[model samples]
Target: MSNARLPSFRFLIGFEAAARLGSYSRAAEELCISQSAVSHQIAQLEEQVGQPLFRRKGRGVELTVSGRLLLDSVGKSLDQIRSGLSRIETYMDDSLVTLVCPAPVVKGWLQPRVDRLLQEHPALCPIISIDETARYIDEMDVDIAITREPLKQRGVLEVPLLDDELVAVVRPDSDGQPAGMLCLETDLTSDRIGPFIREHFGNLRRLAIYDDPRLLLDAALRGHGVALLSRLLADEALRSGQLRHLAAYPSLPLGTLWISRTEGEPRLPLVRQVFDSLLAYSKG
Candidate 1:
């Protein structure tokens, strides 16, 4: 066989991190390295593969087709490593709280306080996962779950998180009022758009929801139409004056956010740790 060796696992990990985050700077920050180091490692990886993996954008980079194919391999290997580490973790008894919440809840709200959690509980680590809306409470892959509606489970302790108003987000330079546009938001909706629209607004004539909020939100940002976005998602835009609420004073009545545990002393300590942290922030 030839003497040429494969790229190091470390290099693969760096590439995977860069590709997953879509920024070399973020990859460096996450991997705890300098941007130059990340770039060098990616260059080495590309040399090993005999092809360019990324193309430069204005200030960053985008993955080439070859890079996208490599991401699947790297992700699978990384996940396997994670699973092996978790399996080993079961032998040692340490406190770990897993929070299963909605996308915006994870990004907008919980993310801000994660550092504080680490400072308080040095030995405890929090695991967060994104769970869908189709009542996957008990079936969720995490120890604690945040749900919009009460989930049916035996001996599960539930605490209300908060209820925030929905707002509309559109491009700032857009010419028309948000009230006269089609709102695009919500993914994996459990209800029909026609009735849901009428339930929230008396006139269901103008609004419709698509499959993914990320897509619709992007469209809204491009001056398309009003998106019925959660306060969690639209808070930044509202604060920056990039968008406005369609209502005179916050018309939508969004329900409560609930944090639930799997019952009894087995999961109580972990549940209490998260509950105490979130209770201070919850309005409900």
Candidate 2:
């Protein structure tokens, strides 16, 4: 706001057009205004800036040193403003809700309950973002977010979504002849689960290691090995009998998963509706 005394946006636009086109008549034609109007705007802007912004060069105009410097700053500022305006258009769309979370939650949790969500709110259009990390809920424009750690920012409300308990599982038909072990990479490095696994199942060869729990789930389903992953991620598979708890090891407590939203009143009712529905689903 320090630029409070700066010339009006209208004058800046006119000045930018004239400077870019290098001709007052061409700028006027493009702006659908009289050539004299462009001249007047330039004169007003230069007066406010305390310098001449342009000089005559044959039939066209060329920018002065001051004009070039102003153009560089004004051009970038205009672009940033235009980009914000464009984002506003998307933000105002009632059908769209931006949801951010890790990929495992999307596969094991949200995907299973999405159909019910749509049935409850047919008009909702979810923009699911699993690939991008949303470190700041307020700054990312995320209506709802699922995170491994709770956000403690002033304007963010974080609630427990799931307990990240590590469980060893395998295909139901393995018949005690399962392949090597498949484990989430994080579990292998964690203080609690890593030592437990190494102490109990040190003889079992590792078939594969994955950074994502969903991948470990798939590998277990295909009978690749006795895959170790979050119990939450394997919830659906276990419930459906596609997989079962490995009898050799007990489930270990890891961490908690959190769901968060921007605290206070929301811009739209649809955001609150989605958040409430997701919260209920997680609890159920």
Candidate 3:
């Protein structure tokens, strides 16, 4: 098909739906079509897009990098149209949604949820706040936030998501040796390294803290201080032996992440949609 005629919004919509939801059956249900129809539409769209959009994994699916890029490209136009219609119906208000999260959590946890968000609520545009500078965080003005501390906020409503946990970590290469002052990429005291310090050494010594976990993992490999980190964040380090659990200590209570939204504002359907998606996303 020619580029001009290739948009095939129906096909693109179906494919995007299938790719993001990870199932042709669900996509079909959402589109009010048969599963076979959903598959044929996606297959045709894939041929036009000139690449495979999804890889079958047993009963579910996962998108390829190209699939992700296509969704990104076409998502905004679709969202705009959807939001415009929503506004015309005077059924909901416009919205801007934002989230705040630590870098590692952004990388491991939230990244996987974006696609599902697109599939579930195509009209809600989102911006993610990842790099949390002390000054910037204080000045942040967002509609929704995912924060570690559920401290009092002026206008935000906070709903706790899950309990964050800290696990021991080290470099994949080095033998777990020496084991004194635990080395971390950055300010360990703030990242929950204090408990390990009190437990392991009896006296807390805040020595040799790097701002990067790569360096801390290096030191841990070289038999430095035990690296305390989130199990989700340190999975690769644990798997490769770059980080190792020094003791079977009870997982550290890093704190609970909350879904914070501004109070008093009407719940935009898109926002409520994403909120529901996230809640279900949490269960999964």
Clashes of each: 0, 0, 15
Instruction: Give lDDT tens digits, candidate 3, residues 118-191.
Output: 87776666767774542122223344556677747675556777566766554544454534455454334644
RMSD, one per candidate, in order: 13.1, 4.3, 15.8
Q: Which clashing pairs does model 2 show? A: none
| Candidate 1 C-alpha lDDT tens digits along 1-284 | 13678789889988999888888999999999999999999999998888788898877788999998888888998999998787557524456666788877666566766787777767777767785543343423456777887776777777777785556556767655445445554422435543455565544245555666555555666666666666766655565676665664234657788877766553436556766767665542
For candidate 2, the lDDT comes to 0.84
Listed in order, each prediction's TM-score against the native is 0.52, 0.73, 0.47
Q: Which whole-number lDDT from 0 to 100 does residue 29 have in model 2? A: 97
Worst 10 residues of 2 by lDDT: 131-140
TM-score of 3: 0.47
Residue pairs in steric clash, candidate 1? none
Candidates 1 and 2 compared: the better one by TM-score is: 2
Give lDDT tens digits, candidate 2, residues 1-284: 24649799999999888988999999999999999999999998888888899999999999999899999999888889999997788798888888888787788778888889999989999988885465466633688888888778788888888877778888888886666889878878978778988987777899899987777889998988888777778888988899999866877886888887788767678888888999898778
Q: Who is ahead in TM-score, 2 or 3?
A: 2
Candidate number achieving the greatest TM-score relative to the actual structure: 2
